[model samples]
Target: MEFFTIKPCKTQAAYVVEPKKPLHLDLKALKVPFDITARTPVLMAMRIDGVDVSLYPSGKMLIQCDEPECIAKKVWGEVA
Candidate 1:
């Protein structure tokens, strides 16, 4: 899919890609637990649908899971 890339993982699949535009996420507002803003504003630590996720300021993201493509589409679709 346009929003992510699928790759094989030990336990499942993973996705790595960037969005068409940068995401404007408010860590404080969202209460994000991880930090990547000092250098690249990368929130490379999060979870959704039990899958580990990472989002970067450059609009890049890494989604790991079994069937990452399907999960990414579902997640992005709802978020977008």
Candidate 2:
């Protein structure tokens, strides 16, 4: 099943991805190539391919990238 939905952001060059159902993610255990810039109990921020990405415990992500769908798939794939 599709893990998440992708929608264009109101501003240019951004996208928001959210899980289909309520989801809680542990940012500390999530493995990605990007560096985690700022992290807290509820939020984690990182940079991927020169774009900003913010991940929340609710399994929502704000991606400032030209190809958000690709990034989303990569992320969800890892988590799943």
- Top candidate when judged by TM-score against the true structure: 2
Q: How far does residue 1 in candidate 1 sit from its true spot (Å)?
A: 10
Residue clash pairs of candidate 2? none
Encode model 2's per-residue lDDT on 5-77: one tens digit a residue.
Answer: 7887778667889888756777777776677899887888987667788888877889997778777776667
The worst-scoring run of ten residues by lDDT in candidate 2 lies at: 71-80
Clashes of each: 1, 0
Q: What is the lDDT of residue 47 in candidate 2?
A: 76
Model 1 error, position 14 (Å): 3.7
Q: Report the C-alpha displacement of residue 57, candidate 2, in angstroms.
A: 0.9
Residues 1-80 of candidate 1: C-alpha lDDT, one tens digit per residue: 26533455435456565556656654334444333333323354566667677655444557775466665565456344
Segments in model 2 whose C-alpha atoms lie over 4 Å from true places = 1-3, 28-31
Candidates' C-alpha lDDT: 0.53, 0.77
